[model samples]
Structures are given as C-alpha cells and as structure tokens.
Target chain A: MKAIFNKKITFVIIGLLGMVLAVTVSGCKVNEAISSKTGAQLWGENCRRCHNAPDPNTFSPEQWKTVGMHMQTRALITNVERDKIVAFLQQ
Target chain B: MKQYITIITIALLTSTFAKAQTKDTIEVQKIGDKYYVIVDHPKVDTTKQFAPAPAPPPTISKTFDSHFMVVGLATIGFLNTWSVNKVNTPTGVVSTKLPTTNSFGDVAHYEFSPMFLWRHSDNILVEFEPSFSNGSLGVNWADITYFAYPGVILRAGYIVLPFGTYNKRLAAGWICKLPTDPVSITSSPVGSDWGIELEGGQQTGKMKVNYDVALTNGFTLSATDGSIANPDVNAVDNNLGKTVTGRFGWLPALNSGVEIGASGLWGKAGDANTAYKNVSTAMGALDFQWVYAKKPVAINIKAEADMQYVTNASYSNPNPPTVSDTTYTYKNLSYGYYGMFSIRPIVADKFFRNVEFAVRYSSYQSPKGSAFENRQDQISAGVCYWINWRTVFKIGYENLITTNPDNNELAITNLKNTQNILYVQFSVQF
Candidate 1:
C-alpha cells in the first residue's frame, strides 16, 4: 500500500511539471510583453507593488541610472525592466 | 532814574541766559586716575520687551539629485501593547505576562533609522542603512553593487543574504504592512553576514528567470554542545568552512505580477578539529507572490515556508543527569510558515483608494528538547493609509496563541506568552 502511495505522489509531481512547461510555451507564443514593457509601465507596475510610484522627474539622468541599479538589486527586477525604467526616469 | 532802569534790564537778561544754560550743560572732572566728563540730557524712551524665535527642525535628509550622490530614507515610529494571560502553576493559578514583541508594553520603545543609497556611477551603486532603536545604534545592511550588464550583477561587502522575502525585499520600515513583524517566519538561520554575491536574470521566450547566490563566513556551532549559532553580523570565521546560500525565482506573468521562488543555504557549522566538526546545517525556503489590479480593487497574496535541519550530535545535558551519563542528544529540526492577504479599492475616491487592509497568519515549531525549543502561532491584521508615495500611517492588532503538550499542564516557560496586542506606527521613507 505504501509503495502504491509513493508512486501516485511521484506521478502527480511529474504532471505538475509538465503543465508548467506547457504554460510557459503558450505564454511565449502569445506575446513578449514581459520583455517589451515600456519603462513607464515597468516603473509603475514594480514600484506600486511596494510603495507609491515615484515621479520619473524625481532624479536627474545620472541619479536615475544609479537608482535603477539599486532597485534592480533590491527588488529583483529584470535587466530590461531596469533599463526601461531608468530611461523613463531619466527623461 | 535812567541808570537804575539800565541795571535792572541787564540783570534780568543775565538771569534768563543762566536758566537756559543750566537745562543743557557739560562738566569735565577728574576721578581716580582718569578724567571724567558728565553730560546731562533729557531722558530717552527705553521700554521694549525682548523675544526670541524657536529653533529650526532637525535635518532629516539631503537630496542626492545630482548625477552622482547619496540619498537617504529616514524612519521614526513608536509602538505600544499590553497582554493578559492566566496560567495554572503547580500550586495555584497565576497571572502571567509573555515577552513583548518589539516596543510592545514599553512606553519608551522608539526607533529612528536612516537608510542611505549612493550612486557612484551608472554601473556602480552603494547602499547602507543605520539603525537607532530604543537608544541603541546599529547597522541594518551595508553593501556595494556593480552592474556588469543588464542581466548580471556582482556585489560585495556586508550584504543582506538572499533568503526569504522578508529580509531582502520587504523588511524596510516603509514597506512592512503591520506594526509588528510576524512571528515564527523570517530570514532563517541568519539575516545577513559579510558576503559576496552574484546575481542575474534572463528571459527565455515567455518566462522570466532570476537567480542569486552568495558565499560568506557563515554560522557557527557551540563548541561544547552542538547547536546552531546564527551569525547575523560581520565576524571572523571560527572554522574553515564557508556557507553557500542562494535563491531562484520564476515569473510567468506578462505584467510581472506573479512570482515563485525557492531558496537554500548549507554550511559546516562546527569548529575545526572539534568533536562535532562533522555537524552540518542546511535550510530551505519557498516563497510565492501574486498581485491583481483592476478598476474595482487591487489584491495582493503572499506566502512562504522555511525549514531547517541540523546534523545530529551529542551534547552535555542541562538537567543533572547521572554522573556517569552526563550527555544527551535530540533531533535538531525547525520550521516556520506564513501567508498574507491584502486588498484596496483602487476605483474609489482619493482617500478610500489610498486605504489598504491586510491580514496574516503564521505557525512555527522547533526541536522538542533543544535550547531553542518553541511552538508558536500568530495572527496579525492591520489597516494602512498611504499619506504619499512613500509615507504611511498604519494601525494594527495582533493575537498570539501558544500551546505545549505534556500532562495537559501549561508550563508557560517561554514560547512567547499568549497575549493580544495593539499597535500603531507611522513610518516614512524619505
């Protein structure tokens, strides 16, 4: 009986992994929205998760570059997101 | 008769001149070793009161708006709480108080912490925070980072470990939702240590993957009795072993609103050449986050679980065992887990839209007979008002329940006395 239970659990885990892989494939086919997000969109989406979105004009171009790096490390943001946000804030 | 009239006129004129001169006159005289002059004049007005203005406010911050500069986040807040509990002792019933969380039950519990970030260049950044709580000065985390590229980063110095979500992403005063930190769940083993880390993220077609790894002078074990000695600060290594810790995250959402993460740490904890030299410790944590935003409302869901296992070893028993057998051993295992849910009405008016409600539940357990033995559960609920983009006013309440089984007797030694607490805090990141 114990062996049967272990086999069932193993099968369930494998099935879940297959589903996750399928979803990944479908999502990529749908759109590259995650990578193509504009700096303004990425800035608002990521900042709003923790606190209110800061004004892009808060820092100068040089300052925003530094802030972009800091936020990437602090918030675990993707490189593309960081670059776009920095570009937007610098503008 | 003519001569007498002339004399009378001259005398009258001379008397008039003398009276006029006496009204305003100067006299010079010598007193002691120096000459002195006196002048008599009509009195001048001298009746005005003196008033002074109050001092200016403290310099809480400075703008690092320049291309290369340093900016700061200043936080100051207070906490208050009370508890009630009834315990039955060996003889009779007793009223007892449990240990307070943070500033709970202490009127003087106050904190003023200043966190700083310096951008040296486009590729180099430095971050550090100083903590001042209840009149003591300490460090939160100080580290420098280098962005090698858009997808890779290299960092060194005393840095926050890539553990659970609490210490890395949300432990800041302005970021936490409640007045008190949730019990039983947090950055496990240790919060941070002197370390070097390498991290990067990449997009594979539709999926985004992020990973971070670190090597540091990790934890130490008690030499006499084999138990974990968490090293949360920068210290010299007691042994030759270096700990390896890291986290990997996956985000499948196009909007970056969902993420699932797994983290782990492992190291040799015993001192070199010690009897417990082979005692190794390992910990792992799983975390999840989801966010929903629409016209009607916004929702946030977060969950995490942490587990630790230490290699078995024998140690001196605390209790007075038989002289011949003074050593004892027990399984060293512990775990903590929590889940949080929060919501806010985004479509409402300005005041209502800024209002958020959050609640969390947590439970944790430790080895049965170890010195760090504990079993605790906690529930915290709170409301937050976003005063601005980075400032907040929060009000929260927490209910803690603890239980230990054995003869159905509540020993109530530790494990945080069971109690209900209320908290209010105002935190700002500026």
Candidate 2:
C-alpha cells in the first residue's frame, strides 16, 4: 500500500509538471511595452511578487545605487528598467 | 526545568514587541550645554550578503512596497506575519527523551513571528522581529537605526549582535529551511542586548566589504553551586570593560553569489562579588555562503565554524572561593561547526521548480564542567515544497548522536547517546 501511494504521488507530480511547463512556455514572450509605467509601477510589477517589497527609503541614495546594480542581476531586470525603479525609490 | 521555563518566558516577551511603533517622532532635549535630536532613520546596507531577488510581481491589487515608497514601508503593510509548525516523532529512544520534546507525535514548535519595520525616511528606521511559540514569547531584536551616510550607520536600543547569517536571517520563517536552528548558533554568545553599533559597507574592486562594530553589555558568570555557571547576558555591563563585537564580510560581486565572513567578540565577565575580578570570555567565528545556479539546477551551500573561550572559569557549589584556598581559575574552551547544502531542480518550472532537497551536518563540543558539556552531532535531510516564494512545507529526518556524560547534568535522557527522529514543518510569511 505504501508503494502504491508513492506511485500515485509520483504520477500526480508528473501531471502537474506538464501543466507548469505549458504556462512557463507561454510566459516566455516579451514583457508588455512599459513606456507608460512609472517607476513605482515598475517596482510594484517587478519587486513585489516574491516577497514584500522593502520601503525605498530604507537606504541612502548611494546605497541604492549599489543595491540597484546588485539587484538588476538578481532580479533579471533590464538596466533601463532598474534605473527607473531605483530612481523612484531613491528619495 | 528552570532554564527551559526561563527561555520560554523570554521568547514570549520578545514576541510581544513585534508590533513596533510606526509613527516618526523627533525629540529635541537640551542636555547641559548641548542639544540632541532623536529621530528615526530607515536604512540597511548589504552587509550580510544574499541580496533577495525581487519577488515575483505582486498579484494583489495593493503593492505594499510601491504604494508607500514615498511615505515609507511602515505606513503600509510593514507589520508582516510569519508562522511555523513542526511535528516530530522519536524512534529508538530507550532511556531518555529528546531535548525538544519527550514523546513521539508531539508538536515541537508552533510559532508566530511578526516583523515590524518603520522606515520614517531616507535617514532613519526602526525595526523588530519578535516571536511567540507555544505560549512562550521572545524578542529577537529591536533597534532604531540612523544612516549617517552611505558609509556609516549608527544603531541604538537592543540590537542583534552581528555574528553570522543565522543571527540575522533565521528570524524570518520563510527563509530558514530547517524546523530548528543549529544548536551551535543559538547556544553561542549571540543574542539581542542593549547595544550601540556602527555598520557599513564599501565596494573595493571586485569585492564588496562590509563591517559591523558594536559595544554592548556583556555576560556574567554565576558562582552559585549546583546551578549552571553559564554566562548570563545582562542588560548592563557587569564590569568596566564593555563587550566589543565585530563582524567583517567580503562579497565577491553579486554575480559571483559568494560571501565570506569572520566575526569576534570579547569582554570582561567578572562582577564585583567574584574572587577573580577580571574574568573574561571571547569567541571567534568564520562563516560562508555560496549559491550556484545554471538553468535546471540551483545549489545553495552554507558553513560556519566557531570557538569560544572563558578565562578564570569556576564551577563549584555555593561558592568557588570556599572550595579552594587560592583563587582557583580555569580556562574553558568550546567549539562547534556546521555545513548545509540545498538543491532545487528548476527544470520542472513553477510548482515543480519549487521543490527543494537539503542536507545538513552539525557538531558541537563544550568544556567538561559546563551545563551542556557533551559532544553532540546531528545530521538532517529534508525536502521543501514551496507553495510560493514566501511559503513552504517541509519534511525531514534527523539522526542525532551525543556522548553520554558521567553525570546527567541536563537531565534529559534523549541527549544521552543516539536518537533518530522524523521532522515536518509548515512555514509562511504574509
């Protein structure tokens, strides 16, 4: 019975894996044109999905410059978009 | 039993402070010939490394980080809730029960932790992470920070003395992968205390170097007989020599995904009543964290090694001076180390990509006459199912081994030799 249970779980996980793949492939398209979005909108759209976004005023402007550079790579954001987001939060 | 109760009580009290004040208040006081202004500053440097990737874009209608970027995080939903529940089953424990629990099928931890951050402005911030577990409350730390500049940050109030990643990151339930933290971490001389600290970081070539220096009230050793002579973390310095602690780390560029750190703390532990007037304690540690990700596979590794020493230590019933004619002084040494590795197969994508496998090994040995004087080893293997980036469910198995002491000083039989247990936990941050 334990073996059968394990097999059932394996099958269920495999089935779910297929669904996730389909969604991910669909999500691979280019992001929507973001020219109209403000820095706050970019920050909201980019930074708030995984964990709660920290207050932008949490660090100095120089600190944000460094943090922005570091996060650009971590968050996989374009340099232009990161600059906009950092500029919005650097107050 | 007394220590257990005391620990639980402290945990409970600490948890209540998680609701930190959000209002920004400025007080100007004339002290003799000088004027002082106390204000809030919300600032933190990337000193500890492991910069959080931007969480997935907010799905909720309200984005806490975005809506209040101008007013500060405190005005929005800065008071976030974190919770964890653990269940354990002990197997092959013949003579004694586990230190965390006695029977199988017992709930090891049911904890609610609240993190409050009040970022008043670009220059000032107040933050606290407090937790309540099984009716016991504890405050991890609470402090008001001032960002004097990009290179200097001054903090006052009860501060979590910087030592390693565990002291800084473990309070957040969603981040720590294990149900319980390593004994080497919690048992060390690291905890929240009344302290003032200056910490900052600077980029040097390819490495970002960060430093933290602090002066705080140190611990004192109890001289009573039949009681634990462990160093008591006091709010006030017992002696004139205040404890000094520092941590320095090097992050080899964010893209490298590696951080290495070393920390040390030293202070006089003697009070007025002790025969040895200048007894002292010192501890040093080395720690590292590294992450490697390539498409389908992501690996995370962390390790730490630390040693502690106490000068002129005495373990005597009632009074140590009475036990010996001369000032009998002994030097006590203790050491501990741990390493952990975790891997996630990202090839599966989305829900499947959230599954992670992890393993950890830890060991500790203390002086022969201290309260926890045994040599212990623990190995844990676990799997985590991430419902999202901020919530997870975990199941694990732990194999614990220890050397039985001549005297059962700790009184728990489960810590005598070898014990095996199954562990499971559910943790989330809202």
The top-ranked prediction according to lDDT is 1
The lDDT per prediction is 0.71, 0.59
Task: Give TM per candidate.
Answer: 0.76, 0.62
On a 0 to 100 scale, what is the lDDT of residue B221 in model 2? 56
Candidate 1, TM-score vs. the true structure? 0.76
True contacts kept of each: 0.41, 0.00
Q: List pairs with backbone clashes in candidate 1.
A: none
lDDT of 1 by residue, A1-91 (tens): 4345335534544453454345434433334656567889988787765556787767777677777777788677767778888888887
Write the residue-wise lDDT of candidate 2 on B344-418 in tens digits: 886855776878888988888876555546787888788888876567777777776766454333232323556
For candidate 1, write residues B146-260 as lDDT tens digits: 8896567899988778877777777665777776666655424567788799886666566676777788888888855555766746467878888877777787776768888
Candidates' chain B TM-scores in the order shown: 0.76, 0.70
